[model samples]
Target: MNVADDDDPPPIVVPEVTVTAGGAVTEGAGAVFTVAAEPAPDAPLSVNVTVGQDGDFGASTGSRTVTVGTGGTATLTVATVDDDADERDGSLSVTVDSGDGYTVSSGHASATVNVADDDDPPPIVVPEVSVADASIVEGEMGALSPLEFRVALSEASEQDVTVRYVIRSGTATDGLDYWGGTGQVTIGAGRTSGLIGMNVKDDILWEGDETLTVELTDADGAVIADGRATGTIIDDDD
Candidate 1:
């Protein structure tokens, strides 16, 4: 009983790993993928590749091993990490990882690369607030002189530049000749200039040179440019 019958062994074709993605990549610049394999796998296949990213983009994931010979196609380079922040612009994925010979195509497995966002967003200052004009000398008889008014800032603001003053009455006379009313002046954080003090009340009678008007009126980050200033009250009783 030995009827020679031996000849039946030729059916082992497992190759269906697809993933192709390349275009739009600027963060450190790197994205090129193609790990195909459809019907060309007679002896060199390997396969196992993964690279991912989807948001905030730092880009660069792992998983390697891609041969795909028999002239099927194989090239995968994915790297992108140029983060300084200013985020927004992400998308990068190329996967075909199953293992052993390959077979993972549900519709091209997975592929997408479009990360673009070079990083740029920082610029917006807004600073300009001025008010200067002064002269003070009115003392004798309960004297209280102090009159200083010079609040400027054309540029030099990282932040903190609040100015909103008011002391109207060009002929002097706020609480009865002078006493700076309603105020707010910060100007600090790189600073440009700041000084606003007013207190002059010397009653002896000789009211000769009198004037008072300091108005800046509202300013947060700053932008009131040369509001208004004039304080002079020099009448040394003579």
Candidate 2:
């Protein structure tokens, strides 16, 4: 019988295996598996790798296989289909089987794919304006009363309106500056009635017959409407 030395131990064998995580990928983006391994100096070693879907990977499966030679790495790209509109979160695994000489050291990794959308609209345009009103008084100090008039709007609009009034006096030949006021008004959609009032100042009262013109304008200073009225002011001395 041959006697074996008690101190002799079997040579330690380190199995050659491959490990890797799929490259950068988006929620909806596709990816493949890769292998890292050790190869013999001259003898070629073959490695087979498989990829499997895991976690939020929902209903999708990958079973692709690839072969790698000694001192070489193999990449097995698994075709992937993404049906998600939003970003998807999940994990995948890779298994490497090296015939006999190696054991898989690292055969698992994680993957992610992203998805997105882009489109939107403009704001609503509103209507706006300016207005002018004029009047003549027939009284002395403290005797004039307020006068009112209606300026008809051409079209009915829901937009908030601003009116500017320029009251002018005199004939069609000579223009005279008179009193006026500015204000804001809202016309309900399709409603047309608008009223403007002015207080006749005793100091600005005109004696005898007079003619006045009122100009109505929009917010942009564009003339939208106008009116002319004649009034007779009685002289206090008469």
Candidate 3:
């Protein structure tokens, strides 16, 4: 198409080389940020990435250069500093400065680098001690058996532990429904389990079901995960 001197068919328009913004990083850590250009430039594209000194965390990395290859892309590393002190999180600005022959793409103009505090995580606390479950059978009207109430720990303790156990009142009575199944249960040193049993009474009652709930009373040395457990008595007389 031909045109007047003032309106000569507009010269062929070429897409200006463009670059986008970068990314964030943490304190005392290293992170790589990338900037991308549209069409490859005829020469190497050097982008000035300005990192304003916002705080101690982000000040570690100041003004840096990103060299875009003929392929139209480059990466810059942002190093952080972890000042092992209790401080609030900080941040810095990383902006793509307007260069010689490139345009800062929309939204690729700037980005933020967050500097997180370096604090040691709290120690993990778990249930170190626990108790074992117990089961017993009811004999005749008056019979005593090992209604073993076992006490245990997740791992063995360094020294012997004497945990007290008692036949706590439950759906079944202590004297009326069962016998002595309570007292100090001794766990030997470096042992995970300790046992204490009680005599369960079988009062030949055709009742439905009776329960003896055994519990640990003394937790002097170790912690208690499950301090209580129930023992069931089945009626045999039909």
Ranking by lDDT: 1, 3, 2
User: Of the pair 1 and 2, which is ahead by lDDT?
Assistant: 1
> CA shift at 209, candidate 3, in angstroms?
1.6
- For model 3, the superposed segments whose C-alpha errors exceed 4 Å read 1-127, 140-142
Best by TM-score: 3
Positional deviation of residue 122's Cα in model 3 after best superposition, in angstroms: 15
**Which one wins by TM-score: 1 or 2?**
1
- Model 2: per-residue Cα lDDT over 23-141, one tens digit each: 65544455655665554323444555555664443324544445555556766555444554333355556666545555666434333322221112234444333233434443433
Off by over 4 Å in 1: 1-3, 7-13, 16-24, 27-31, 38-71, 74-91, 97-114, 118-123, 132-158, 162-195, 211-224, 232-238
- Models, CA RMSD each: 10.0, 12.2, 13.7
| CA-lDDT, candidates in order | 0.83, 0.47, 0.67
How close to the true structure is residue 99 of candidate 2, measured as C-alpha lDDT?
59
- Model 3 scores a TM of 0.43
Whole-model alpha-carbon lDDT for candidate 2 = 0.47
- Residues 79-164, model 3: lDDT tens digits: 77676666677776667877766777666677666667777665543325556666656674356655666667777766777787
Which prediction has more favorable TM-score, 1 or 3?
3
Greater TM-score among 2 and 3 belongs to: 3
Q: Tell me the tens digit of each residue's lDDT in model 1 across 1-238.
A: 8798698888887888898898878877888888889888877889887777887665657777879888888888777878788878888887887988678999888899888888788778788888899888888335787888889898899878889898888888888778777888898989899998878888778779999888889988988978998888888887
- Residue 76, candidate 1: C-alpha displacement in angstroms: 11
Question: What's each prediction's clash count?
Answer: 0, 16, 2
